[model samples]
Target: MPWAVLRLHRAALAVWGAFLLATIGMLVWEAGINADSVRDRIAACGHDPGLCRIRAVVDYGGTIGWASTLVYYSFFAVAAFAGGALIGRELENGTAQLAWTQSVSPTRWLAATLAVPAVLLVAGGTVFVFVFRWAWAANRDLMGDDWTFNDVFAARGPALVAYGLCALGVGALAGVVLRRSLPALGVACGVMYLINHNLEKSREDLWPTVASGGSGGQFHPESHYWPMHLVETGIVLGVAVVATGAAFWVLRRRTG
Candidate 1:
């Protein structure tokens, strides 16, 4: 069953591999070559104290920021693939029915369909998150990012993996409910987008804001960001579990 699943999704696996390689390559370049260049510019500016060479650093930061943005938003692609390729296409073309008749239980088929992609998503997302974290922290002077930034928040920790898992769950639910490729793809993407958007907006509320001075002064300590991120990760993971359970339940009802 695993081999058959692998064979069926070889194209997606290849694409995922290529994306992972490209992201890692970009991070390596940013952390190595671009970081060196930024450091050199900083040193040169310090020595001269006249020519401001900080624009170069900012430009490089912008480039790295764009690359990281793509990685941060990769869950959308995962959701699309899960809906359009993984389950929807199979059900639409009667392939899932064929598999079911070949001594494969509906539950097992659904499990394989979700499990294989979930593993790959976690592996790929974790690698990108760690690499991007290193690259992002390598030269803080070159970056204008903060913990509150959307892409930074999503790309820096286990939240990235959580988002991928949640997307997969939402996609599975959409595919099972719609049982069509295009509609499932569209609905899944939309649902994931909403989930992400809402979460990003309410992320700060996950943890209470620290009031430093008087009633007029309220600021979030940097130390609180990690805890907030963990809380958000838990929320996303909870969503994933619910969606997955709902998908399985729906599949069982439909098949039985």
Candidate 2:
């Protein structure tokens, strides 16, 4: 079952592997090799604005931002793949039903489908989290963004994995319910956009914000990263659980 699933989704796996490798290489090279040069150039400027506007400085920041942004938005692709290719295409083309009629049971088929990608996503996400954390910490002086930045916050923690898993579950549910490819793709991406947008808007409210003295300004401290991250992760996982359950329920109803 696992082998069949792998063979079926080899294209996606290859793309993910390539993306992971490329991103990791970029982060390591920029942080380990290029960062010092960028810092030195900036320091050499010594308050000279024109000299600070060199290519190395811009490239360093641009590379880091590009990698982080790609990592952060990867879930959209995951959701689209899950809905359009992984689940929806199989169901729409009747391959899933044919598989059930063979040795593979419906429940086992669903489990294998979800489990394979879930494991791969977790592994890839963990590597990305650790690598990004190291890069972000190591190149702090070169970074214009902080822990509170959207891409940095997400790419640095387990929330990245959670978002991917949530996307998978939502996409699976859409595929199972709609039993169509393109519509499921659209629905899954649309739903994820809404979830991500709302959560990002309300993230500061997840943890208590520290208030500035006299001025009465309130903002989350850097220490709130984990608390807020875990809270958001829990919420996302809750959605994943619900969506997975609904997918199963809908599958059983249709099959039985």
Using lDDT as the measure, the top candidate is 2
- List all candidate RMSDs to the true structure: 2.0, 1.7
Instruction: After the best TM-score superposition of candidate 1, give how far the Cα of residue 56 lies from its true spot, in angstroms.
Output: 2.1
By TM-score, the best candidate is 2
Q: Write the per-residue lDDT of candidate 1 for residues 46-135, one digit (tens) a residue.
A: 666444665766677777777778877888988898888898999999999999999999899999988888888888888888888888
Q: What is the lDDT of residue 16 in candidate 1?
A: 86
Instruction: Kindly state the number of residue pairs that clash in model 1.
Output: 0
lDDT of 1 at 197: 93
Question: How many steric overlaps does candidate 2 have?
Answer: 0
Alpha carbon lDDT at 122, candidate 1: 88
Clashing pairs in 2: none
